[model samples]
Target: MPNTQSRLQVRVIDIHGHRGARGLFPENTLEGYAYALSTGIRTLELDIQLTADDILVATHDFTLSTAQTRNSEGQWLTGTGPESITLTAAELKSYDIGGLKAGSPYGAKFPDQAFLDGVTIPTLEEIMVFCSDYETSSGAGSITLNIEVKSDPTRPGHTDRAEKTVDILLALIEKHAYADKVIIQSFDWAILDFVQDKASHLKRSYLTIAAHNGEHATIYKGSPWLGRTQCLSDDETIPALIKKAGGNNWSSLYKDLDEQAVSEARALGIGLYVWTVNETEDIDRMIDLGVDAIISDYPSRVQRRLMAHQMHWLGDC
Candidate 1:
């Protein structure tokens, strides 16, 4: 194991609460986001999908999951029921995603999550409004938003096209004047590329996971989710491809990161942000690696580690 007590001589690594601290709160719900903010997390990492009516909502999955959402009638959604792209915002609001289904495999993963009943998936606009209001009322600084566009090219018709998704999200950011505070990110390189081509002023983060064999293999290829690979070179590392895609930051699966890649990414001027890290040991390891940010399901855990080393980003928060 890496030395847990050794501190890296670098700037404080920002703690990005993944899905608003998914291990403790309902992922992507306003309630969860609020709780994360109360915990002094200034940066929030979330996912966005288009509703059937073309409204953008903060949700991780393209469809409602049986493990975390229940219908308006109060029954758990089963077997990947309706795609968000097929349901209007009003129709999508009919489900309660405030709590996870008990004893389900997905719920089992977040054993410490505090259940909050009657919470619904919130629109991206709603979240932005809430954050703006929170900053005003609490006198805290604005929250940094890392918004991920949830698009999968392999699953045609399941979500909006990459261009449309970026346009909608960019419009929302412009409407709220959040362009300066938000970091647009996605696993889909096409989406990042489009943002680069159009809204070059806004920051973009490229999210990646290691390539898995068979059905999930596109993760490591040029663009697994799309029909044609975009700037994919089998010989290049994920970070290199992200830089080529015009991303300013490289968000990688924490487990897939290594020292050489981290060093190379830094050399390329791409900020390194690792995701979903929860354990203290893993947290320590990431800190030792001198990553720019740690996107974790348990931001409090990261906070404590930072505090122990006197490297907390928010300073005594």
Candidate 2:
């Protein structure tokens, strides 16, 4: 475990509310985002996917999950729903995603989430504007948006090409003048590579999930997810790859991180942000690891943990 002094030696650990405090509110909705901001979390982490009309919306899944979505008639989807790209923005918004269905296995995961009706999907632009509006209305601190592009290399047909997705997202970021306030990320390294090539001014987080449930990891050599530029050596660490690829940050699965990886990232000057750390023990472990940021479905839990260590998410706020 790192002492408080050693912890502060690294960098202030940013607490990014994953999908806007998914444990406390519905995931990826404006309502949830508002709750997260109220907890004093400046970094808001959400995912984006394209609609049939080419509008980018803040959503986690490429397809609708039966767990939270309700059709216009107020019925829960029996199974998986259509790809987000198949629905027009207005068509998608007709469904309600304000709350999880009762007695659902997925709903069981977020037992404490507050249920709110009539909440529809918000566009990426809408979310940004909402945050700005919130600041203006409340005179609160500024927000740092961590936007993840929902592009999967394994399922290339699941969404549009990485280039097109990057272009659309970059345009919105530029249009909103949020280029400096956002960190663009994707599991598809091709997306990050495209951002690096064209929008180098934007910060990019290389999101990597190591092998789980017998699935292949994205960091391995020759993985299509790594894009055209990655011809990596077999033993290349993920942090090293981030450095070589000119990434501003590396957002990784919290379980896969260890002290060695932390040290390597620090030595190489790469920012480390771990995702979805919810349990108190896991949160404490991440805190002790001296990571640059912790993305969690429970931002308040992380905030408490940081304060217990005589630390916090934002300084002078």
Candidate 3:
């Protein structure tokens, strides 16, 4: 690993637009992505779910959420609608996710998000095309795609098998010639393992939250998505687990990371990227930790924080 001390001296933090600037625009919509791009955000962080026809679509939730989505009939869904896996691409596209329900608790969370109408979910291919077109027209470099594969071992049949999901995602990345610009990330470590074996050339990020704690502090005994328990020992740390699984980066909930974890990851040459760090204090904390990247709903906030420290470095695709 390079000298952590030196790395801190010349901080060049990468800013990833979370769900395409969800706080400022409709989450996961094409318009939202466009707005994020306008803010000079080169890394577009998004989630992907497989439609019934096996097409990859950009969405944060596996099921249609009533909080932000409206049905084809233009009525707000009372509860969770059909799962994305059960709907074809065309069927999934009919639902509008442009705006959150007004005055609801969900809408209150993103008070500044522009409320738009008639926005539909964009497919993975569609997003790639948009990025290509935007770069061509604007003369900006290509944007990096941080694609999170949404999967849960506990929720069987809600998503494709890990192997199948990786195969399909890899095919799309190859088809778009995006292997160099894509980072496949997942909370499900099994998919990371599959990618390591199947497409070692592609970059992978291991995502973690504070779900596992206390007795289940170690990933081996804590993470339910790892599938098998024998791949790692109960005493292993998350950074060690990520390295053993062939992940190039460790993406964790900012609060769950400590000085020790950051030092361990840096010592192992694993890049650190913290998620959802929106507030000024949290952004400052992440920067002080010397993380490689910060994924946030407000890229502008991160940019501002970096600017204050004279460490803001605009990244190309």
Candidate 4:
């Protein structure tokens, strides 16, 4: 265990509200973000999917999920809806995403999630602007956005080409003067590589999942997710890969992390951030591990954890 002085040495935990506090409100909706901002979570983590017309919109899944999406007429989708890439921004947002289906498996996962009516998907720019305005009005100061660019090399048709997607996002980031406040992250290393090659000044976070029960893991050798330029050696750490790619930060599944990897990441000067750690015990363990950040669906729970250890997410600065 870390001593009191060592624990106090941590200035801040850097709590990022995952999908705008998914456990408390509708994921990735404006209302959800408002709730997260009200809770004093300065770092808002969100995902973006490209539309058919090349507009970037806020959403998680590749398909418009039957779990959370409803048609313009307020009827819940009977099955999975068409990919966002198949619809224009206006067509995509026509579906309501403010409430979960009554008996959806996804809805069951977030029992406490509050529902709102008539909420629509906001474009990435809208989300950014809303956050900026919120900061000014609430005096929350500079807010950090962890924008995840959702892409899959294997599923090429679901969205636009990675290069085009990256270009669109970069344009938006530059136009909004968000270069200083954004960390462009992606599970697809190709996207990160594109950002690194094009806008080297921007921060790039390499996202990884060593193992998940059903999700694909990108750390293995020859994984398409690592992009064309990167591949794992027989003996190499994920942090080493990120370092090689010129990334200063890495986000991984919280359960896949161990002490050795954490220490190695620190030694390499890589900021290790864990994602979606909602349980109190797991959050406490991450705090003990001394991660650079904790991405959680329950920002308040994470805040309480920080307080329990006499620490703060905003630090003492």
Per-residue lDDT value at 116 in model 4:
87
RMSD of 2: 3.1
Ranking by TM-score: 4, 2, 3, 1
lDDT by residue for model 3 (98-183), tens: 88888789899998999888999999999999998998999878799999998876687743467888899999888999999999
Best by TM-score: 4
| Cα displacement (Å) at residue 126, model 4 | 0.5
Clashing pairs in model 3, backbone N/Cα/C closer than 3 A: none
TM-score for all predictions?
0.91, 0.93, 0.92, 0.94
Instruction: Flag the better candidate by lDDT, 2 or 4.
Output: 4
What's the residue-level lDDT of 104 in candidate 1? 94
On lDDT, the stronger of 3 and 4 is 4
lDDT per residue as tens, model 2, 1-317: 24535534534679999999999899899999999998789999999988778889988888898889999989998867888877899998999998998999889999999998999999999999999898888877788999998887777564356678788888988888898799998888888888999989988999987655136577776777776657466567888788878887999999889999989899988988999899999999998898889999999999888877778687552
The local lDDT score (0 to 100) that residue 38 gets in candidate 2 is: 88
Please give the distance, in angstroms, between residue 282's alpha carbon in candidate 3 and its true position after superposition. 0.2
For model 3, the local distance difference test gives 0.84
TM-score for candidate 2, residues paired by index: 0.93
Q: Which regions of candidate 2 deviate over 4 angstroms?
A: 1-11, 158-160, 231-234
Model 4: lDDT of residue 188: 90
Q: Residues 17-132, candidate 4, lDDT per residue (tens digit)?
A: 99999998999888988888888888899999888899999999888999898887898888667877778999988899988888878999988898888899999999989988
The TM-score of candidate 1 is 0.91
**What overall lDDT, based on C-alpha atoms, would model 1 receive against the true structure?**
0.82
Runs off by more than 4 Å, candidate 1: 1-10, 158-160, 212-222, 225-233, 315-317
Residue-pair clashes per candidate, as listed? Answer: 1, 0, 0, 0
